[model samples]
Structures are given as structure tokens and as C-alpha cells.
Target: MENDVLRNIALSYSPMIDRNRAVVATRLTVSALRTGGPLQADQLLAAIAEVWPEGGTRVSLNVMSETLLNDLLRAKPLSNVMIEIPSFIACDPVNTDAILQLQGNTLLLHGRPPSMLPRELLPRFKYSIVDLADDRRRNEVAGQAEAAGVTRSVGFVQSGVRTTAEMEASFGRGAVAILGWPIEDVVSQSGGRAGQPDMAVLVELIRRVDDAEDVDKLDAVLKRDPTLAFQLLRYINSPAFGLSVEISSFRHAIMLLGYKRLKRWLALLLATASKDVNMRPVMFASVRRGLFMEQLVANSGDEEMRGEVFICGVFSLLDRLFNKPFDELLKTIPVPERVYQALVESAGPYHPYLELTKAVETETAPVINEYAETLLMSLLEVNRAVLGTLTMAAQLE
Candidate 1:
């Protein structure tokens, strides 16, 4: 009956994209109460196979109790299917031996606990670790395994418990920590935990760069954080700016990219400091609005006007970030009069475009259409351009 319910749920929500390759899999736990007869395993496997087809479905049997192993071995008719054996299950001798001889394709160990398996039993199957919350233990296990020459792929599960220091340490030691949530969540939670630089420090770093009259001082500050150094190198090498040669170091990038470009890059990084998914869509929208407004004003041959438009669009979403009203945050940043007017009262020249962007974001379709018509642009053209800008902004991270 549980299998039937799962099958119904799977069928109700179809795959987002239909492809021949199988990406979705089902997990199951075996219990002594239900493992009374062979027919139980047979029925469960049949139900999953019916929904996802052979080789397309993966069934993991989480062994919570030691007595379930005997029932699993007795149910060998289902051996052709893949099953997951938890690493902790090795605590039981009989279950340990059964797992070693099970010939399964995948073994999922949770928490990276110390393993006591015999040397001979380790090489038979592929395995991955799950729920690895403690970074110190995770790194110790991964490093020891690598040093012992265990070549099978090792993956870390990010339960959001590991600090930024743990993540940097694990990454430095060459372990792939699987971040369970989005990158924003990782940034928010991990910041300041693993000695990862704090936002105030980042802001100070940017200020130092801005105040530096010489390239050497700026380069020294940039090198303080390897991650920031890497991002600067990547931005310098990106094809969008069309630079002639590869920038090898922070010093070289500072000399070549100039202070203005460096400040812009730092601003972009600060904007992405938070990894909250709730704020991602808002950030993306703000970036798009800023870039689009800049392009519009620049094409009109008004350089100063373009700068104001860009600042206006970017600061438009400031309230969402600081959790205050827009006017309240505007007073904190030193922006131009026109930009302030547009945000506060929608009275400036750029106010119409800002209003249009807000209208689209709020799903006021009629208002968006009216604004496009008023601007002498086709509704489809405006929408296509706005969506294209949005897509580009989202990839900034």
C-alpha cells in the first residue's frame, strides 16, 4: 500500500523534462515486520520498476535493525536490483558480512563514521557518504581514505552544520563537499564560522582598494583571501571585457583592470554575499534593471544620465536586502538627487522604466503592457529584452 501511494505520487507529478535517461530514483527501508515473506520484497520492487523501469530505478534499503539482514539475505531473488547499505550497519557482524557479500552496486554510509570492514571486503562495491554534518570528522575520513589509496569516489553531504572553515579545509584537502542547499545558503551559514571573511571586512577591503593610489597596496589586500583572489582572476580573464592577455596574479590584474573596474567587481561580490534563495530572485531582478537602464541611457549619448540610471536601478532593491523600506535605505547610500527622486517619488526621467520593471515583477500584466505601449515599444520586445537581461544577471554568481 505504501508502494502504491508512492507510485501514484510519482505519476501525478510528471518529470519537468522528458528524456530517455533516468535521473529520478526511489529509496526504501526494510523492516522485519514487513519482511515476513519473499512476496513483500518482490511486490515492492515490482511497484518501483513499474513506475520507473529497470536500470532506471534505484532502491536503497536502510538497515535500522540488525535482524532485518537475515530477511534481506533470504530475499535473494531481488539481488539483481541495486540496494544501499548504510555504513553504520557494519556495527553488527552478521550484517557486515552480508553487506560485504551482497554484491550490490551502491553503498551509502551516513555521517562518515569510522569503518571497521576487513581490507578484502572494501574493494567490492562503490560507495558515497550521507548526512556528514561534522566537518572535522568528514575531513579526517576523506583524508585517511585517500591516503590509504581508496580510489572509489567520495562525496560529502552538506547538512548545513559544517562551518566555512570546515568547507575551505575540506576543499583545500581535495574533497567534494556536496552543498545540499543553494550556494547562497552555504555563504550565509558558512560566513565567519571557518574564518571565512566577514561582510564588514569585505567592505573594508573594497574601501582600501578605493583609497589606494598605487597598485601594490591593493594587490596585498586582494591576496588576503584566496577565494576573492580567484574571483578577481576569473573576472579579468572573462571574454566580455575583451582583454588581450591572461592575468596571472592579483597584482597584474590590478595594474591592468584599473581601480574603477576593480571597485565594480568588488561591488558585485558584496552583492552576492548572501545565499538566501528568497533574496536571489530579487537580486537578479535588480541587476537586470540596472544593466538595462544603463544600456538605454548610454545609447542615448548621455554618459552622466547613464550612471544615474544604473545607480537608481541597482538601489531600487536595497530595501529587500536590509529588510527596511526603500526610502529608509536610500538615505544611507550617497546617491545623486535624480536617483533619489526616482526611487522616492517616481518623479525623475528614469522613474517610468523602474515602475515598468516593478510592474512586471509583481505580475501586473496589464500595467506592463500599458507601459510598453506608452514607451512606443512592442510588448513582446520589452518582455524578451527584460527576460534576457534577467538571465544574464542570474549567471553573475
Candidate 2:
């Protein structure tokens, strides 16, 4: 089939764990059809399956034509699929009756106030995507959802930008899930302060680890913090590592991971020390990006280039991690110019790898295809790499 429709496809994840406590619901946004357009059902379903291989994708069809809408409503493909319709459709008694007849199907109401949804039909769907963008509007809708006894959730589809405090507030106001906005982007940098003893030690340790080639020195430095040592040991021994025999000693860890991988882990450890809920999704994204980049390089028969690209992928989010400018932070660390240029200027050789990695995250199929072709890859290759990265990330989590 032609891949035209897939070009406008983008995936947004639910930031919070769902009611059933699933990891996250990957929401598929059909940008082309969002504003109303002609889309064949086959192409549309294929695109959804491609992005969300596992079922349970949340899709909103506010702009779909009545014919296509009724087709999906009749078929009832997957119970895991949450079908969202606008208030205009729900206001129709016949349409509402037909939707409620679907066996155990989940529904969401969008494009109207929660108060506008018929009270009789409120129990048919699972939750409402409340537009809590403004302070006054948020409080109002939140109360409406509350009175209707519907779970309140806000999506950043229209909201400009939300802060960590605001997300926490929404969660407090009974937001079961947050859509679109990345929580990491809005977290305050006040979590870090200059000249603080613990902060200084972590920074110093990251710097020292980057410079350390001596095994004894590396082991001693890691031993300085029992918590760090334990975390490292736990990670290396996890099933994700796939070690035939468990590694029990620092010497074994050094032998297995090597100095380069060791330093990379230390950097990531420092980057992810915060227990902030917002940071988890960002960290996962960073790790997934790095894995995606590393896999691409690995397939290109560039053995030595693997580590550099992996580092590029992993540390690409230092700006968010340390809550400082990447270049300013790079000054304190000893990253090679190749990695720095790729990250900061996007002009280096490895820069294409980083760009392709990001393209996998947010770009359309045509754009991703162009990047893949430039990298001597096919769509199948990119898809396999993405699957590998997602699998690895799940294990690490």
C-alpha cells in the first residue's frame, strides 16, 4: 500500500500510568485527518497498527466524516482502542445510543466542555479530555468532570505549556492521564544549586569517571557511594544485560562493561538521580533515542563509531537533565568535539545519526524515509531498530 497517509502520523504518549496501571498508552494522532479530510479505512488502520503494534491505542476522531465514523463504530475493532467523538455527535440521541451499544468499548469526549456531555451518556465512556489550559477554565472543567463523576484528564493539544507544578496540580485535581505535553520540558531547574556539597560531589564524580582509565581508580570512586555501587551492580545483573553468569565483583563489571560503557552509565546515573515523576518519561525517551542511534551505527559496519553515536544519543538531553545549557555544561565535561558538534551545531558527521534518531520520534514517514535513505537504510531497517530500542528500554525500566 502507498505510504502517503502514514506521513502525517505522530505518536504521543500518556504521561501518567492508566487506570489499569499499564505502562503508557501510545496515542496515535492523524494530523492529516485532524482537520477533516478523506481517508480510506484500510490505510488509516494500517498506519495505526504500524505505530501501535500492540493494541490499546487512544485515537480521537473529532473531524472524521460521518460515513467513516459509522464504519469504525460498527466494526468495533479493538476494545483496547479508545474511540473519542466530539460533543456534537454525543448530543445526537441516536449516535449516543449506537456508541453505548458497543460491547465494553472505551470512549472519550472531546471538542466540548465536560458539562455539555449528556449526564445519561457520561457513564458510557471512560474519561473526559478536559481543557484545563487556563487557571479559571481548568478549575471550572475539573469541577464539571467531578460533578459528572467522570475521571478528569487534560491534554496539551491546545494548552500552550504546562509546568511540573501545574501537572502535579492536575493530578491532584483527579487527572488520571495527561496527554501531549512533556512533563520534563517544564520541570524547574531549582532542583540544582551551585556550591552545594552533594551537588558538587555528583558533578565531580561525573568528571572524574569520564577521565578515569584506571580500573582501581574507577572501582574506588564507585565504591565511595554504596548506593551508586548497588545500583550499578543491580543494573549489570538485570536480565537486560543477558549475562550467562552473574557479575559479582567490581573487577568483573569493569571487565564486562569496559571503561567507555562504565563512564556512559555513570553519566546517565548522574543525569537520572532525581526521583521526579516527570523525569522518568524524559529519561526513557533519551535512552530510547540513544539505543536507536547506536543500533543504526551498529548496522552500518562501523564498530568503533558505535560508542560515539551511543554517547551522542544518550547525552543529547543534557540540557533537560542538568537544567543548564548543553554547551555550558559541556565545558565542565570532557566530551570529544565530534559529539559536541553533532549535539550543539548539528554539523558533525555523527549529527545525521542524531537527527535520524529524533526523526523516528516525531517526524513523518516521508521525512523519516529521506533520512533513512541518506543513512543507507530502509523503512524495515528503521522499524526493526525502533522495535529493538523499545524492547531494550522496557527491560531497563
Candidate 3:
């Protein structure tokens, strides 16, 4: 569908985290739509399904036109998509008529409750997307919900949240979910002083894998840390792995994955072996970066280079992951010169891929365009890598 008048579509997603900090659903925004014109409903829905096949996808329609949106809503098959509409569009006569026509499709999303939304329009929207900053300006949670707290609104997802305090305050007010995690806030406090997967057992397992030892031997190492063993199982069992039956043992998971893919997965998983629960978002980003960078070079590189590039992407954030400088961390774990060069020195062939991955993550259209142009890759090619990585990474979760 590349030539279907759609070009350079870039997607950025925010995990809709529950109170427990686990992702319940994903909020997706089409940061950049087709260069030709507004995207069609079928194309957009198809793209969402392709990227997030497991469902629990909330498609934000802020970039869509009211006419196209109404058309899509009327004809779209997936009634389960949580459509988030802006205040201006939701109240529009054309869109409202289409929404009301469906009758059962009352799950329209908009600003915080008691927002500019007219009193009569309240019942139509069961979900609220509150910008924490703006909401605080009007109805301050500062004094209202103190230590003990007051009654908070349920089912509203707070956006514009970027700090630990803001997240706590948002939840302190009873928000059902948070739109996105404060990864930057957490990482800032960490300030590169992070944990590592250099645990004795993990190091041994890495050695065993590198030495081409039997899977059973590796299993022995994993048994030392049941959590590590479980993570291996979960990652291998992830939908992206495409195993027919469940793998109850680390040895079995490792055997099916063989050596090459296992090496790549292990490289990404090692960085995420930290016990700090707050690093979930960072870990998530790390894994996706690895996948995104790997996919970006899939068409151009050899098998071994692809794996190294993948490691390069995962290890780029090694400073923030291992609680140490790049030189210090790389000294412990054996990495290729290129991977080290890209991560520590940030000057290598893979460095441009790393830079492009960051730009794509931020969903900055012009910057992404610049990187794509510099890399001499078509926007369509770059976007495919972006969407493909997002889809695979989501499956890993």
C-alpha cells in the first residue's frame, strides 16, 4: 500500500500505563500522516492493526479530518478502537452526527471531565484524556488531595505527565490510567548511575552461550536467578517469537531460538535485567531501539553486522542502564568494536542509525526527514522499520 497515496507515515505510541505501572493499552498518535493528504480510514486502521496486532490499541484522531474521521467511523470494522477526539472536533456538528448515528459508539475520548465540554456533552464521553498541566491550573490537586486524599475521577488517563511527583499527584487524584510513562524523569534521577546485568549467573550464562555449550548447561546458570529464568521464558514466549507451544524451561526456549537470534535477544535482555521496577520504560525503549536499528539495516547488512547493530542500539543507553560510564560497562561485557564505537564514541556507521532511531522516537517530522535523507533511505523505508519495530516490541511486552 505504499503507493496508495500514503508516504512517510510516522507513528509514535505511548503506553497507557495502569496504576501498577503495567501497560494496559497503548495510545497511538499518527505524528506524521501521508504527505499527499489526510489518510483514509481503511489505510489508517490497517496500519494500526499491523503495528499492534494484539489489540488494546487506542488510536488518536487529532491529525484526521472530521469528514474522513466520520467516514471511517461509519465504515470501520474494528469497533473496539478507543477513538480519542479533541474538544473542537468532538463538538463539531458533522462528527457528532456521525458518532451519534452509531448509537453504541459512545466511547468518544476528549479533554478532562468538566472541561470546555458543555455540561450536556458529558454523558457521551466515558473516557477523558486530561493534560495534567492544564488540569492542575484550573482544579489544583495541590491542597485538595493531601496526605489522606479526596475522591478522584476514575477512567481518566492523565497526559502531559513527565515527573514522578506529577504521576503520584495524578494518581493521588484517582486517575485510572496514565497516558505515557515518565521515562525521562526517572532516567534523569538515575543520571547514568544504573544497574547492570553483570550478575555472576548472567555473566556465566553469557560465557556458556558464547562458548557454544549445551542448552542444559545454560539452564543451570539461569536456575540461579529464577527471575532471570522467567524473563527468558517470557521473552521467548512473546508473540514475536512465534513458538507453537509454551516453553516452560529456559533450555527449551534457548534451543528453539538457536544461537544467532538468542544472542541478539540475550544482548537486549541483559541490559534489562535490573530489579528496579522504574526502569521498565527504559528497558522497553532499549529493546525497541535494538529492534528498530536492526530492522533499519536489515536490507543492507550481513547477518553478523545486523546483530552487532542491534547490540549497538540496545547498548547506546548502556550508561543509563548500567549505572556506569560506557567505557566502564563495555569493559565488563564483550562487545564488538563497532558496537563500542557507536555506543561509547558515537562515531561509526551504526551511529547514524542510532541518531535516526532517536529522532523517530520523538516523532519530530522534520528531524526524522533530515535523518532519513542523510541516510539516503526513502521515508517509506524508514517508516516501515519504525512501524515494524513498534509492532515487534509491543509483542515482546
Candidate 4:
């Protein structure tokens, strides 16, 4: 059922960042629910549980039918799930009765609780998700939960928080978490090469790939960094790789996957090599970006082009990771001309694809629609890529 309905849905996500800039949760947005069909609450949440089992996934949704709300309750013991209901739904006597039957940390109030709510029902909501993008909504809902005699188990979580200042402001106003990427906060706090001791090994390995060195040589380079070798082997062996035989060694993986594919994985590994806890979400986004980029060109029948785009997507965040401009870094680590051009020059054949990839992350329809039009891509293609890569990302993780 999850598979049957997933095709009609395009899933996008943002990490719920905490005061320490750690990704404490993930906020998943479904691009189409009502348009696709009646939202299948159970299948949707079941899929989420499988995708992010560590929990703390705030399922950003609004108003569900009585049957759908009942289905959500049956999705009990979803220990990591948090379903947001607009005030209209949460405050309704009928809905409130059903919501009280919900198990785990499953309810999040998307707006301020009306004074009409019975006082005891307030605590059922784990946290109030206030949208920072709306000044009136934030002003109305942000800090008034306490005053309303609402006892949110976890403080308010500010949604639409896109910048560092917003994060600071959200925390200052007593938000337990902010919904969205803390890219600026992560970049500002990143230690770059100073923190990532494996940078030298990764650089050398990448250089060997660029020079088209033999597998034996690449194997030797990987030997120098056991941690890097282990990371690669783990990914190859993961169910996502879809390999029959377990890849027990780096040499074996290289021989099996070939340089072109191996290079893509290496790029993913490099972008995610940072040890900073705050960078976890960035790493999460990089994997999806790389996979989405590859899927965009999946039918192009140009394997080389697909791999190049994948690297471009992954390396999109290298500047933030290494704390160096693309101009300086591209000189040392060789990338495809398309990738280099897109990242450093921001204008090339691949540039449009990169723009589309970033726009997909925004999860804003108009922005995505504009980019898709620029590249002559249909929304269906875009949705397929988004959903496919997210599923792949789930298996990869």
C-alpha cells in the first residue's frame, strides 16, 4: 500500500534543528495529497516510519477526514511520528475526542489553541508548530501557548525558519526546535579541514579517480584511511546498493561498481565526511541531491552525464563543508567540467539542473515549476525523481 500510493506523492523534508544546531527531528512535506487521492494516513506514516525509524519526524499535514483521522490513530506506537493539525481540527470537539486517543508523541498544533479547548486536552499536543514565515501567525501563536494554559511537552517549534537570525530569534522566544535547515548555522560553526582529519585521504583518492588510476592504486590510497574504506564498504553493502554478494573490501567494491559509479559514491562520502553533529542534516540533503540529480538524467542513456550530475549535486555543498570557496577547492580536487562549471561558474549545461535541484529542496511549487519549465521537464518527471531518490536515500541511510 505504501508503494502503491508513494508514486502519486512527492516527499520533501527539512531537519528540525535545535539550539545546539543539532538536527533533532525531520519535517517531511508531501507535495500532493488531496490532488493525488484521499490521503492514506496509515500508509503514508508507515512509509515515514520505515524511512526515518530513529523517530522525531513531524508529519506536516493539515485537516484529515474523520476516516483518515481514525486511520492515523490506528498508526499507534509510531513513536517518532508527529502529525500537525490546524487549529480548526485540533479544537473541534469531535476531532479532539479522536486526537486524545492518539498514542506516542503524535500530535502537533499548527496554530494557537482556541480558548474553547477543554483545558485537559491541551497537553495532548507534544509541541505547537508556529510558522515563522507568517508574522501574524507567529506573533499570534508563538509565545501564547503558555498563557493559554497549554502545556506543550516540548516547547514550540518554529516552522519556516530559513536563516541563522531566525533560529536565534526562535530560541530566544523559547522554541525547543526550529523547522528547516540550519545551513548558515552549520557553516558558521563548521571546523572544515581542521575537524575532518580524513580530508587528505579523500583528496588523494579523488585525485586518483580524476587521473583514472588503476583499481590497485585506488585500493592502496584507500588503505591509508581505514575509516574511509569502512564507510565506502558499508554503503556498498547496504541494501540500497542492491548487490547480491556482500562487498567485503574496497578493492572488491571498486571492481564491482566501476570507477564512474564508485566516483559518485566517493563524492557522497566526501560531502558527508564532516564530524560535526550539526552537519548531519547537510549530509542528509547531499545524498538526496546527488540521487535526484542522477535520476533527472536516468533516461538520457548517457551514464557519464548521469554520474557527473550526481557529483555536481553532492559537491554543491563542498564550500560549506570545507569552508573554502569553490574556486579554490576545484583547483585541488578535479571534477567534471559540467560539475566544475555549475559549482564555480554557476553557468553551464548542468547549471539549470543544479538550479532545479536546489529549487526542489525549497519544496515551493512555483519555484520548482519555474525551474522545471526552464529545463523542459514535466512535473511528473520531477515528482518521480523526488520520490525515487527519497526512497533510495532511506535505504542508503
RMSD of each: 16.7, 5.9, 4.1, 4.7
Give Cα distance to truth, residue 186, candidate 1, Å: 16
lDDT per residue, candidate 1, 1-397, as tens digits? 4432221111101110001112122233332222223334444445444433444434444433344434554455243355545555544465656666666445555455465654555564454444434555554654686688775445443334223344444445444433221223333443323223633445566677657657776666666677777776775576533589999987776778776556555655554444443344344445556765664444453656865676677667655455545577555444568878887887877787787765554444556666756666554355334433433442343
Please provide, for model 2 over 23-136, each residue's C-alpha lDDT reduced to its tens digit, 9 standing for 90 to 100: 365443333323235445455555555444445344443324565566566664455556766667777766766777766666776656534666768777666555565434
> Per-residue error at 266 for model 3, in Å?
1.4
Best by TM-score: 3
List, in order, the clash count of every candidate structure: 2, 0, 3, 0
| Model 3 CA deviation exceeding 4 Å by range | 1-8, 32-34, 53-74, 102-120, 137-155, 187-200, 207-220, 237-239, 242-260
TM-score of structure candidate 2? 0.69
Model 3 TM-score on a 0 to 1 scale: 0.81
| lDDT score of residue 286 within candidate 1 | 59
lDDT of 2: 0.59
Provide the lDDT at 1 for model 3.
Answer: 31
Predicted model with the maximum lDDT: 4
**Local error of candidate 1 at residue 194 (angstroms):** 18
RMSD of candidate 1 to the truth, in angstroms, is 16.7
lDDT of 4: 0.73
Q: After superposition, how far is residue 224 of candidate 1 from its true place, in Å?
A: 4.1
For model 4, the run of ten residues with the poorest summed lDDT: 55-64
Q: Which ranking of candidates, highest TM-score first?
A: 3, 4, 2, 1
Local distance difference test values of all predictions, in order: 0.50, 0.59, 0.68, 0.73
Give per-residue lDDT, candidate 2, residue 294.
77
